[model samples]
Target: MNPAGSLVESLLPLPVLLPLLGAGAALVLAGRPRVQRWVSVGVLVAVVAISAVLVAGAADRPHVLTVGSWPAPIGITLVADQLSTIMLLTSMTVTLLVLLYAIGQGTSDDETRTPVSIFHPTYLVLAAGVANAFLSGDLFNLYVGFEVLLMASYVLLTLGGTRSRVRAGLTYVVVNVVSSLIFLIGIALVYAAVGTLNLAQISERMAAVDPGTQLAIHLVLLTAFGIKAAVFPLSAWLPDSYPTAAAPVTAVFAGLLTKVGVYSIIRTQTLLFPDDPVAEDILMIAALATMVIGALGAIAQDDVKRVLSFTLVSHIGYMIFGVALATPAGVGAAIFYVVHHITVQATLFCVAGLVERVGGSTSTTRLAGLAAASPLLAVLYFVPAINLGGIPPLSGFIGKLGLVEAGVQDGSVLAWFLVGGAVLTSLLTLYAMAKVWVLAFWRPRDQLPVEHPEDAEFNDLDHEDDPDRRFPVMIGAGRAGSGEESYSGAFLGAARTASDDERVPVALPRGMTVATGTLVAVGLALTLVAGPLYSLTDRAAADLTARTPYVTAVFGQTVDERVTR
Candidate 1:
């Protein structure tokens, strides 16, 4: 422990606490949509501010808070290490942007509920859950954080009540629930084996245990978290469900959820079971399969959102590759990669929503001529698409380069294998993005058609009892633009009357431009600040590798002997 340093603390609880309190307020004010929006934004603003303070504090000193001050290993603790502080900051930024976007989107317009007030409270809870997960120092605390957000997510995913959405949501719910159960069971076994749920204590205890039992627990915990992370074989449910949600919901979910899983993997690997060869070996194999199979699925998907969702799965392998390397440089690269990927993925999803809004259908088959139709949007899609594909100068390329460099330095067969797999995945990612670009943006507009009038009527007819039946009208209008596409009689009438707003000539209501623009600005901020941002990430990575700060913060003392990795 660095006893020479002064203890640092602040009113850091605002990040999570404000959101929780605001959520209750929002639920109480459910009848007032405007009030709900304001409340959600205010909560997010406070969260973002608190996160900034934490990040700044982490730059100077590690910030630790014991909930009830029982002591290390017994009391619940929240430690703002550099990695977690950065995650908190990024989560707040994304959440704020999404909330603004949703505001402009209007709650009544959401397909899920007539009064969109539940979104405010649920989203706050979800954000708070994420902050809690990132900051928690105890294994049991992490479990509670996961449960907190998962319950909210179950509702968010099933927001709209269409048959496809309901079906997809059900699958998502079942898979996540089963994974959560496994996680609880794993926690129980770990506690039984080690006598404590404190992460540092578990790390200390694991060294004294027999290798076989340690290996069994390591594999069990990995399997549970692997499912949460959507690793190869356990990842089938992500693609089936993520694409069906509302765009804002999908964007937030995509940004935060899998990363939470990856965060768990990072925590467990570094803290709980650092030297388990079986776990390392499993990660190596799983990283390859996840990257390959996920990319293949992206290649085969016609839906633009679905393609991106599969690509998200593919990219998770990259982070797993870093964890598998088990080196300072590798871990650093993984942390950097996580922030870059989260922002990039969320931005891409937000843009996908825009694409669907502007071009009518997100299906590659139905989308065309976006480049000519709305060049600004085309720019939006292109830059992030290229970033996701690991083009030079973008953060994605920088992150991947660091990982590959670390792999070369490690010089193990497994590390080399992961490097090769990463390269292949990058190529596949490029191919997938190019497929989207070619099919949706480069094609002539005449090849695509707006929705048929009969189909429009059918959609309305089929979902008449549904809360979101009105959305098809707006969605149909998003499809009306581009070059020479013709619409059915009914669709043409609806499309012509949709809107005169040059920003969105489709089905979207005139009021949403502000919201869409807000989220877009969030993406822009990351790109504009990439220089200073990467520096922060690099420093955070360095701190994350220096294990003493975190250990001392949690336990108030550190062991003299260095633990073997």
Candidate 2:
């Protein structure tokens, strides 16, 4: 390889390495948040730069690193193909901006549920785990990556340790632990059957394995990933759990974690078990159910976070729809949708966070007149909201178009059904968003549903009310903008410092707005660059379908050579 190739490959591992280093340093500097912020944010920014480099370099060739001087199927290998590199770039961008938003939250609120230092370390660990999952070249390492991120997420989810958080966190913990156990069991089964844990090796050896063994192992792995991805029946945990955490924390989960699961599914299905009819049929059915059920669920939601959470589940079906098609166009559409959803979804949750701050609540029923109070907040919500709802000219529309077109090209009856389901789901999603917009942003605050003493908070759903805390303050409240005069007042029981005019000026920490806005811009950037981006994903899906670039990069041997050997 040339020097340029070596440099690109060398950077393949840095996204995972640097974040672990920053996490440790953050732990060391736990007492000084300022230093920790610099360390964590600086590390993530560097990762973003490196991930972008990997994307640029991987347009033609994948970059691979062999750990401990060991060869493929022996040592831990890190890989960055067009697919993984793009995922790294997208995830890192979101993680960096979200970290900045989190920093703003820490600086503004001064609420000490969990200190900034601790949040920084845990958050960095989470980022590292996300990178590891994307870059891993083997199954064992992939499982390890999930565990690492799950551990970090457990802490992040229950950060405040509030009753709602703790209760929901417990459910989340049990579900993931069970999924992880199933995953481990599946790994053991895979190794026993295939004689190797490396993904590249498994891909080479899978065809020779018994059909029954393949089916069993495949089902087990899909079940595990499905639980993590929150696909329909496996999805009951997300809507309840995510709404309880702080805004930034929930946004991270909403944006990154399930997508990690989706990424795993993409890798496993395409590389190891491409074009399996049983798998495709199951995935197609699952996709249809997930789209309809998740959308209906979202329409029933009254809380901001829960609505977004259900929407998150609904969109996972879109990604699965791409996978079910099992064509290059299908996979490319899935990848594009994944990127679009991550940025757009995180922006909505951040806006939801801002809503919690500006309106003093996340409930559409309890909040009102946000269009009058903070037009900026409304606009912030509007762009991503429409994007998520598949309004035209946005990346979301492009992605959905790609998926529907792929389904049409597939020409299978099941595929056609899913294509229609997807369109219906899109319409339902828009309706849900419009419902929130009408109630939360358009209605006058005085006309909000009057809260009786017996009326439970939106998050309560059915959980018994804890006497100790009925409605604790949302975190991260500082004076709104740096230049704006801070008026001491309240908006619908929300802690507010704003001018007393009919339209209260909503002031958010500038960093938070800037971070969220940057992501919104990135989401838009995808639209502007859609042609190039789709071309890149087109090549990536071709590579995954070919299955040679990834295998040769990992094993240092051609597929023919491996087969002959």
Candidate 3:
């Protein structure tokens, strides 16, 4: 290997290692919230820088590192190819921004009930897990990555310890536990059939196995990854689970976790069973179902967070559609869409949090006149909402266009059907976004109908009823003079203050706003750099299709040479 290649390989492990080390440092400095925040932010920034370097270095060939100087097949290996490095860089960047938003939330009056001590360490562990999953070169290591992240997520999801959050966290835990068990069983079956768990070795040995056995192993792994990715039938748990957490927690999870599952599917499918028509057909069907059903579900939701959660599920279909087509254009489009969704989805969730902060609830029935009250917040919401809806000249539109073109190029009956389904899904998504805009942003706050009859008596109260006339009399949990302290647990389960006098409006934190705005700009920037980014994804897709660069780099020989040896 060249010296440059060696240097890149040497840096491959830092993305995973630095976070784990930072988590430990955070644990030691648990009592010092400010110091812990600095540690966490510094660690992630370093990871972002490292990932950028890896992306540049691994563009042409993969950089492989064998842990503890062990042989490739016998010990763990980490490989950074174009696809993994791109994902690594994108995920780390988003993670860093979310961390800053979280810090801002903690320092503000609207501090999350979750302790900063626990939040920092758990969050960093989650970052490490994402990095590990992207770079893992073997099946077991990938499984380990999933477990690490899942464990951290369990903590993050139930952070506030509210009954609703605990209930949702339990549901999330059960579903993931079952998925993990299935993945473990699949790993066992693959090892029993092939003799090595190394991904490159398994790819080479898989062809020699019986066709039936190969298909069986492939289905088992796909089922496991599909559940994790929240594809349609397996996705019912997500909407309930995600909306209950804090804004930062929900943002990071929405942006990165499911994408890890998608990344796994892309890696295993292209590397292990690239020629399986059965799997491709199955994925195509699943993609269509996920797209249509998720969008429809979003339309039915009245809550802001729930709507975004549903749309998140809906867009996963686009990526699946791309991968199912099994062509360079198809895979490249899927990769591009993944990057676009991560940025847009996270930004929208952060904006939703800000809405809850200002409006006291995320329910459309409870929120109105936000544009009149805070035009900046309204702009924050509108740009990404339309982007998610696939408006022209945005990253979302570019990605969908690539997928549609690839489908047309294929000219299969199923591919053509998918193209139609994708278009219909986009239109449905636009409707859903518009509905939220009209009801939550455009409607007048004074015209909002009463949501709870039991609290109607409070609606009749005059200014004289209040001892301190600092703000208007409270009308249930929906109306206040300042529009910020009505405190309904309608969506986020925010706590209500004891007295209306204490219900002064809390200003939106500048750090949180900056973080969200930066993410939104990043989403727009994707459109500006679409040409070069798409070219990179195209080259990455070419590498995934050929599968030689990864194997050769890992084993120091081509698959043919290794098999012959």
lDDT of each: 0.75, 0.85, 0.85
Q: Mark the 10 consecutive residues where model 1 has the least summed lDDT.
A: 489-498
Residues 348-412, candidate 3, lDDT per residue (tens digit)?
Answer: 99998787766656777656777766788889999999999999999999999999999999999
Q: With candidate 3 superimposed using the best TM-score fit, by how many Å does residue 246's alpha carbon deviate from the native?
A: 0.8
Q: Which model, 1 or 2, shows the larger lDDT?
A: 2
Error of 3 at 24 (Å): 0.5
In model 2, the Cα lDDT at residue 21 comes to 94
- Check candidate 3 and list the clashing pairs: none
**Which residue segments of model 3 deviate by more than 4 Å?**
107-112, 450-506, 563-565
Q: 238-262, model 1: which lDDT tens digit per residue?
A: 9888887777778888889999999
Model 2 over residues 1-565: C-alpha lDDT tens digits?
5888899987888898899999999889876656767898799989999998999999888888988879888999899899999999998899888888877663333435566656777888999999999999989999999999999999988876677788999999999999999999999999999899999989988999998889999999999999999997899999989888888888888889999999999999999998589989999999999999999999998888899999999999999999988999999999999999999999999998888766656877667888877787888999899999999999999999999999999999999999999999999999999999998888876664444444434334312344423233333323232344232334443322223324354576576788888888888899999999999998999999889999988877887886799
lDDT of 3 at 539: 96
Query: Which pairs of residues collide in candidate 2?
Result: 109-476, 109-477, 360-494, 480-507
In candidate 2, how many Å is residue 9 off? 1.5
